[model samples]
Each structure stands twice: as structure tokens, then as C-alpha cells.
Target: MSGADRIAAGGVTAHENNRPPKIEIHGIERIFLKKNETNGAQESFVALKDVNLKVESGEFVTVVGPSGCGKSTLLFLLSGLASPSRGEILINGDKVTGPALNCGIVLQGYALFPWRSVRKNIEFGLELKSVPKKERKEISDYYINLVDLTGFENHYPYQLSGGMQQRVAIARVLAYDPDVLLMDEPFAAVDAQTRETMQDELLNIWEKTQKTIVLVTHNIEEAIGLADRVAVMSRNPGTIRDVVPVNLPRPRRIGGVRNTPDFQILSHHIWELLQDKGSRGGSGAQSAAVPRVDIGEHIRDDAVI
Candidate 1:
């Protein structure tokens, strides 16, 4: 086998080794009420239907689907920010009752306390749990360094750049030492270059902390690059269509991976799935616009795993 193929095959073998699931989602469905524009009547909107997934301990999973596909709704349900209309979600075999301290959420908007300094913001959760002041400072210092915002501890959110602000948000959550990290399009607002940097930084941090992460994003490349598996969801009344294992090697560089044959093949596969959904009247994410490659297109010679 080629080196890349060996690495890919080994990853699958390792994954297949039986382990208990850290998160179990069974027959989950979410419904919402929306006002009908035509008759001023409340309409029941089925955002998700019968969505089932199991994420193994310490694995990184990303969920991707078109717009209105209930991706965010699923995250909300998992976080206990909202309840499923039907079915159950369990963490470590325990039913999710409400927003517990074990789950940490980093939202798309950065959601930082503008009035607080970076150090103070990172200490917010610790303060809420009434952690000792000395312990809180120690935890804050560790995560701030982990996210690489060491010197900016005293700076306010307004003073930091977009990427820096997001780092503070991440540090705040990490300070609480949650078992699962739920990120909803956290890098969507940053510039492309900064976004890639953040991606690398995040993977580094994920390695260091070993937190089970479930991230929701509209970006196809981002999903494949970061996740051990990508959960592809279908349109409104969402359901998981596939769980695509990322066979690429670890220590992936996002820019380099984008040009690899393996990466292109995987990316094309996902693109086709989304395109097929779009042709069938399923609206895709506005954030992703992967180019269509013809069968005759040139494949790069020096492919990287």
C-alpha cells in the first residue's frame, strides 16, 4: 500500500476497534412554530427528523448540510439549549436533561462580554461556579496560553482582532474544563487567512486537551479538515445521510490538503452530495461554493496525505 493509503487504512482499523460512545443521539426530532405569511396562522415546522448518531469518546466530529437542514437545531438539542420534540440525546449514557456544566458552547458571534477584559472574560465561567480566585487565575492563564493569546489577557474584546476575540471566547470555555466542546460556525466570521490559522491552532489545542468536540459549520473543507468523521445531513426535516470518515493523515495543513488527490476526491464526493441535494430543491449553505471539477481536469502529481 502507498504510505497515504496505509495511514488511511490504519485510521479506519483504529476506529473500528470497539469503544463505548461518548454521545448517543437516537431518533431525535425538533419542531418549531413559525407564522404563516399567507394566513397569519402558526405552522409547525419540522426542522429535524429521526436523526441518530453516536460519537465515540474523544473523537472530533463535524456536522455539515445545506441551509435550513437543522444542523444548528441538532446542536441546540445536544447542548440542552432546546429540547427535542421527540426522541432522546444522551451523553456518556446519561440522558441530557438540561444545559449541564460538562458541555461548553462557543457560538458563531464570539459572544464575549464587551465590558470585561480578556482575563476577566476567561474567568467568567469560573466565577459563576465560584472557583477560588487563585485557581481561576491559574486556569485562565493556562487556556489563554493554549489559545495563544498570552499577552492580550488584559485587553478588552473591542481592542482585539476578530481572530483574537474568538480565541478569548474559546479560552473562556476551556477554562471551565468541559468534557465536550460544541462550536457553531466559530470561524465563519473571520477572514480566510485568519480562519486557516485558527483551524491549525484549534487542532493543536484539541490534541493538547483531548476534548470531544462536535462542531457545526457550513464550510465543506473546514469540516473535512478538522473532523475524524463528517456527518452529512439532508434538507428540512433533517436526517443524517452519511458519516464520512476522514482518511487523511494527522497533522494536516488545511492549505496543503486542499490540493491533494485524496482531499480533492473527498471534497468532490461531498460536493456531489450537496449538489444533488440542491438539484432536488434543497438549499445549500451560502458560505460554501466548492468549484465543479470536470472528469478531464488535471489531478496534481505531488499529492499529500
Candidate 2:
């Protein structure tokens, strides 16, 4: 199906009707000026151009692309950490002017404080907001358990494993109660087993919280498995090639779905989209045409998988 048709056919949930998208990117372009080492002259490099996407409230959208495709740059714009040279981004009907508490960002580095215990680290945002100490403890306690880090509340970052540290980072963001969650390669640092475990845990948490999430990843399977729609991007003046809807059933287990025919099909399709030579060009219309077939129709043909 085409991206527009899939969206009209329920890429967004029924309840989101009549509401503005939770996140909207319209005609966005970002440029950076760099000095040439050879001549000491400045040149403008286009990092992203003509990017547009809409993420519904409570939606889990993943952006996937090859390296240097401005995936991280897109996240920074959404978080209001950077501005686009043109176009605009809106969150819940308000234009993103600067950093605000309503959105929380989690990075792959697990930017937890080494000096603080897990409980303290999770409560840091609440403390900055001047939430009462009693209430901060209550909030921290809830998220610690939510991310399954209840027993290790008092442990320091240095004492925990990589996965545990990441959980702490997630709980910390959730404790702030942001309406939107932006993640940049948040699981890339972990072992494969741990990454899958984290993906499952994140889905469980999303089900309970229903926060709108936008995650950026280079891992195709991870992008397909976790998102309601995967926004495939192209590099060299980055642009969203297509937003592919994932029709897989949820309460999804990352490992459980990996070998399924539908999963493989979606994976193969996204892989092809990334690898398609047309994606490297200025226009994405050619690459977007590849997903027009009904994905299920390909399942019966064994060779397709």
C-alpha cells in the first residue's frame, strides 16, 4: 500500500481522530556550515531536506536509515535541541520553540550520574521540578518497578550491567512523565540478548503508559518489530523515503516474531528499501513504490521469504 492509503486505513488509531498529530514534521530541512581545513573557507552542507512525517498520539514510530542519514539530527529537532533551516515541528499543536519538560529524550550512552544511586538518578528530574521529596520517592518507586529495576534501586551506575544502566535511564525519563519519548540508538550499546530483552521490556512499559515514542535506529528488525510504522530514510541530504506500516500483531516478543513469515517479509522489504540505489538520489518516489503489494500475498510464495 502507498503511505497515504495505509495511514487512512488506520495507520493511526481510531481514538486519534479530530486531533492534531502528537508530532508533526513539515517540509523540514537542516543545514550546517563547516570550515574547510584546506582553504579555511566555509561551506554549507545539507544534512536533511524535505522531510515530513506525522506521529499519532500514543504511537510508536521508528526511523531507520543508513549512517549519516540525519536520524539523530531529526531527533534533536524534535526535542527542540536544534532548529531546522526551514519548515517547522509541532508537538500536540504547539510549535517546538525550545526544550520543554513535556518531552523526554534518552540517549544510548546511558547518561546516568555515576555519583547517584539508581533511585537518586531517577528522581533527578523530579527534584529539578521541585516535586516534594515524598512525592518524588513515590514516583521513582513506581518507575523503578515499571522497568523491572525494583531491587537495585540503591545501586550506582558503575555497579550495574549495561542493560541495567539503560533501564535506569528509561525509568528516569518515565518518572518525569513526558507526553513524548525520543530515543536515539538507545539499545545499540547492549549485547544482542540484552537488546532483545530491553525491546520487550520497552513494549511492556509502552502498553502501560501509552506515551508517544519516536525511536531512531539502524537495526531494521528492531525498527520493524517495535514500531506502528517504520519511517525509512535516505542519506546525502536526508529525506524520509517512505513510511511503511507494520501490520504485525502486538504484545510482540522481539525474538518470537523474528522467524515469522510476515516479519521476514517486512524485514526484507525494509532492507531492500535501504539498499535500493534510488534511495541515494534526490527523489524517493521510486523507492516508495516498492511496498504497494499486499504483504500477505507474498507469504504463500515460499521464494519471497
In terms of lDDT, the best-performing candidate is 2
In terms of lDDT, model 1 sits at 0.80
Report, for every candidate in turn, its global Cα lDDT versus the true structure.
Answer: 0.80, 0.83
Estimate, for each residue in 1-305, the C-alpha lDDT of model 1 and write its tens digit.
Answer: 14334434545653565776889999898889999999999999988987989887889999977667788889889998999999999998899989999888998789999999999999999999999999999989898888899889899999999999999999998898889999998897888889999998888888888999999987788888898888877665577776667877777767767787777667666555554432322334421343423211211111121
Q: How many residue pairs clash in each candidate?
A: 0, 0
TM-score for each model? 0.86, 0.87
How far residue 82's Cα lies from its native spot in candidate 2, in Å, is: 1.2
For model 2, residues 1-305, the per-residue Cα lDDT tens digits are: 24334433555453358877899899999999999889999999888999999989998999988777799999999999999999999998889988888899997688999999999999999999999999999999999988889899999999999999999999999998899999998898898889989999999899889999999988888898899899988766688887878777788877777788677767777766676532534565643454524322332232123
Query: Candidate 2: which stretches are off by over 4 Å?
Result: 1-16, 277-305
User: Which portions of model 1 show Cα errors greater than 4 Å?
Assistant: 1-15, 277-305
Residue pairs clashing, model 2: none
| TM-score, model 2 to reference | 0.87
